[model samples]
Target: MTGEELGRDEENTAVAGPVDADGSAEIGELIGRLSGDDDLDRETRGRLLGRLARLLGQSARKAGAAGVARGKWLTDLLVAAAPHIPIRDLETLRAHHHGLIGEELADSVVRVASNGTTAVGAAGGALAAVEFVAPPLLLTAPAQLAAETLVIAAIEVKMIAELHAVYQVRVDGTGTARGAAFLTSWARQRGVNPLESGSLTSALGSAAKSALRKRLLKTLGRSMSTMGPFLTGAAAGAALNRAATKKLAEHVRKDLRGGADPIKPLPGGYPSVGPADKP
Candidate 1:
């Protein structure tokens, strides 16, 4: 099927179930907005998160009925949502982080994202004990975990993109190209080295998409480990998420610190968008 036809089907399958809250936005769109939104206060963020949890529950049930978890479905939603994630350019990054440069700026973004994802895990895990007592809530437990998975993924993707900017290793291309590169970076938990061959492909080709789907599945498995009695899920989820984020940050930061400087088209010319499409 063509991209349009496939997307249409995915959209139908994605939104097949009941409305989670007042709005009609899909899971990925919500995640795109929630990722690294500096303006959102805790209360507003909490409300949006509730909506996301309910939506994930609905989507999970619907997809489960159809067949597998639709890993492709989740991957497509996130790729489409990537460009919409609010990432600060270097100037904005410095201003927001109080003129932080180099490692300082990278550290601030990593810490904030790690803390935020840890809190997301805790909130999702808080329902673990009740899930066993209530059948309805039990069904939602996996959904909650799925929601946490996607949100954490979004935050990490945002962090990866921002860290590149902080390190002066710009991935030059259209918004879509850049988004795919960053998404791939997050999927592999590695920094983008523009000098590498096909480092910033126009999109996630078949091999790249498969790798991303697998990574996402692994992270979801980590979320599943949080389900336990006696309210242990919360603690487990928080610790796992914090550690994962920190580890990813360390890996990406190391690669960026050693990678080539800002990307410049070589004589052979790497892939690039036309001038009109430049952001």
Candidate 2:
């Protein structure tokens, strides 16, 4: 090859080298960004979600190419990505709910988060239904499923983080450290252990790994169950997602406390609704 051609090739390789150089770290950063409490506009929020989904899709693709079973690949991905899922900080969450505090703030967080997860489930179901009939779209199902899995996981992670905020539990760490703390909580489906050290390591251990795998399998099963005929699948998908999110939240709440009543609602008989509550 000519010298000029060789130089151009080297430049291209240099540019592509760093993109996948630290795959896990990059994935964690993306998750952190999505789960963070940044005040992004609607369009920007949508774009970040899309980016995270695409990264997940690529992760699945790479694993499949390496001969990993689809189910196992997905479980592994979810476990690795969980800690990085961006969870909103208490200040941002409280601000969004305006005058809500304690149980009332917690209620608003779950309500909004459940709505978001349910929407993702419905959309994923509809997409699956479409892929069922369209030959041209069949190849997209796995990627779509992978994306859906990450998005739903992120939502649940957020729920876990915010619930801790509600209970006045302090999770120690900033940035990824904080994210990892809650990731462990989500994997175990329980509250954070304030006394534990290096929660990120614990989260990646065999016990946490097993827990996450089981949880993801259950979620995947629910998604797969909605793969019937189109209309039926869509309806089932929505209801299934909504119910599942509520169920998960209730269980986590109980684990946080012995199924106690919601922190008594704030005084004045009602919460001052914030802008977040508006459509």
Query: Per-residue lDDT for 211-248 in model 2, tens only?
Result: 55667666776776556668576567668777877777
Residue pairs that clash (backbone atoms under 3 angstroms), model 1: none
* lDDT at 136, model 2: 83
| Over 4 Å off, model 2 | 1-58, 65-72, 79-84, 173-178, 195-203, 258-279
Q: Which ten residues in a row are the worst by lDDT in model 1?
A: 1-10
C-alpha lDDT (0 to 100) for residue 145 of candidate 2: 59
Q: For model 2, which pairs clash?
A: 35-86
TM-score of model 1 relative to the true fold?
A: 0.78
Shift of residue 27 alpha carbon in model 1, Å: 2.3
Candidate 1 regions with alpha-carbon error over 4 angstroms: 1-24, 37-46, 61-67, 197-201, 259-279
Tens-place lDDT per residue, model 1, 111-166, is 88888788777766665656676876676766666677788888898888888888
| Candidate 1 steric clashes | 0
Q: Global lDDT of each model?
A: 0.67, 0.56
